[model samples]
Target: MILTREAITTAVEHGDIVIEPFAPERVSPNAYDWHLGDRIRVCEGDELDAAAATRVSEHVIPAEGMVLRPGRLYLGVTHERTHSERYAQMINGDRSLGALGIWVHVSAPLGHVGHAIRWTLEIRAAQPVKVYPLMPFGKIVFLSTAGATASYQHLGHKYTRTSGIDISRLYEELR
Candidate 1:
C-alpha cells in the first residue's frame, strides 16, 4: 500500500507532512531526491586494515577537516529523522570505502524506524554537497496511498517500501 503521487500531494497540502527549502527540480513520480550537506565529521585513527573498519565501537576520533578523503568514512545523518527524533550516534569506516560501499547505517527499515531514531552513518567522498547535514533531505506530503487505495475498499492502512531499494536505484537513475 505504497503512497501515490496524488495522495502524497494532497497530504502535503494539508500540512500533515513537511519538507523545507525544496529545490524545484528533483521530485520524481514517487519520492523526492535529496542533497548532500557540507558539514562532515571524519573518523580518523590508526590506518584501518581490512577487518578493523567495520564494527566500529561507540568511540569516535574527532576530526577538524572538512573534505572527505578517499578510504575515509564520515559520521553523518539519516534521511528519515526529524530534529525531534534523531539522537547523536556514530559508526566506523569500512576498509572498502569506495563506490557502492555504505554511506550510512540502517538499523531497521526506513520510515518505520525514525519515530524514535538512534543510529549513525558513515559517509564517503563522492561529490560536493551544498547544504549542511543537520538540514533535512527530501519532502513529505500526506501520502494517502500508504494506508488506503482510491477504490475506497481499503482505507487508512500503513505501508512502507524497503529503504534499501529506494536508495539503491537512486544512483542508477541518476546515472
Candidate 2:
C-alpha cells in the first residue's frame, strides 16, 4: 500500500524516511513535491550504442531558467536528496509540467530501498519548454513493502549515493 501524507511524515520522524532540506509545505496529499536541481546533462552524438558508454555534457541551469527542446534527452536531478529504509519510492511528473509537454522521467521512476541520493531524471519535452532551477517539477510517493527487504547497498546497485545527474551505466552491464 502507498503511504499517506501523515504516514510519510511519521516515517520521516521515525528515521525510516529522509528528505534533505525538507519543507513541510511541499508535502502533498500522498507525495512530496520535489524541485529541479541547478544542473543538467545531455548526452553527446546522434546515435547511441547500448554496449558502449556515451559521452555527456553538463550545464548549470541559470536562475533565469533554461529552455528544453524536443528531440533531445536531458538528464536532470532533483533538488532534494531522499531515502527510505522502510518503503519503496516512485516519482511522477507534475500535472502542470505535463500540460506543458514536459516529461520528467521516461521509464525508470522506481527507486529501490536504501538508495540515498538526488534522483536522476530522464527529461524530455514534446515542445520547447522553459524550466527554472529550484522549480517544483515532480512528486515522490512512498509505498510500504512486504516480506523480507534488503538494502540496495547489499545488492550492489550502480547508482549509489549519486550527488547529481548520473547518466546511464547500462553499458557497464553490457560489457
Candidate 3:
C-alpha cells in the first residue's frame, strides 16, 4: 500500500521517519517534498548517459555551490528505507534553478552505505555541500499506482514481512 499523508505525518511524529529541519507542509498525500541542499553534482550530457552503462569513476564536487544566493532552495524527493529491498527510479523534471533550471535526483544504488550524495547550489555564487537521506522523493510520485503487498510469519513465531508488487507488470504500466 502506498503511504498516505496521514501515515507520513504519523511516521514522522512517531520517530519512524526523520528529516533534519523538517517541515509539515512538505508532506503530501503520499510522499514528502525534499528541499535542495546547498550542494549538487551535475553530470554533463555525455556523463549522464554514461552512467546508464557505467558508473562514474570521478565525482566532481565543487568546493562550494554555484550560483546560489541566500535563502534560495532546490527541491527533490526521498525514499522510505523501511523496506530493506531498496529500489528507486528517479526521472528528471523542470524547475527554475537560477539559470541552470533543470531537475535531478540524488542517489547511489546497490551497496552504498555511509557514502552520501553531494550537490552544489549555484545562485549568485557557488557553494558545494552535502545533504543526507531524503524522507520522500520530492513528493513527485508516491507510486506509479498503489503498490500491492502481502506478508507472512515464520514457524519460529517471528513475523517476517514481504511484498507482492509485481515490478514487471509495473514497468509495462509506466511505459
Question: In angstroms, how far off is 168's CA in candidate 3?
Answer: 26
At residue 147, candidate 1 shows an lDDT of 40
Q: Please list the C-alpha lDDT of all candidates, in the order they appear.
A: 0.35, 0.89, 0.33
When sorted by TM-score, best at the front, the candidate numbers are: 2, 1, 3
Model 2, runs deviating above 4 Å? none
Query: Where is model 3 poorest over a 10-residue stretch in terms of lDDT?
Result: 159-168
lDDT for 148 in candidate 1 is 25
Cα displacement (angstroms), candidate 3, residue 55, comes to 12
Give the alpha carbon lDDT tens digit for every residue of 10-114 in model 3: 766776444455678877676556554322323223332322432212222244423323233332222322221211212222243222433343331211111
Scored by lDDT, model 2 comes in at: 0.89
* For model 1, the run of ten residues with the poorest summed lDDT: 82-91
The residue-by-residue lDDT of candidate 1 on 35-93, one tens digit each, is: 33333445556554443333232322233323445575555543442211111112222
Clashes of 3: 24
Better of 1 and 3 by TM-score: 1
**Per-prediction backbone clash count:** 4, 0, 24
Each candidate's TM vs. the true structure? 0.41, 0.97, 0.36
Worst 10 residues of 2 by lDDT: 153-162
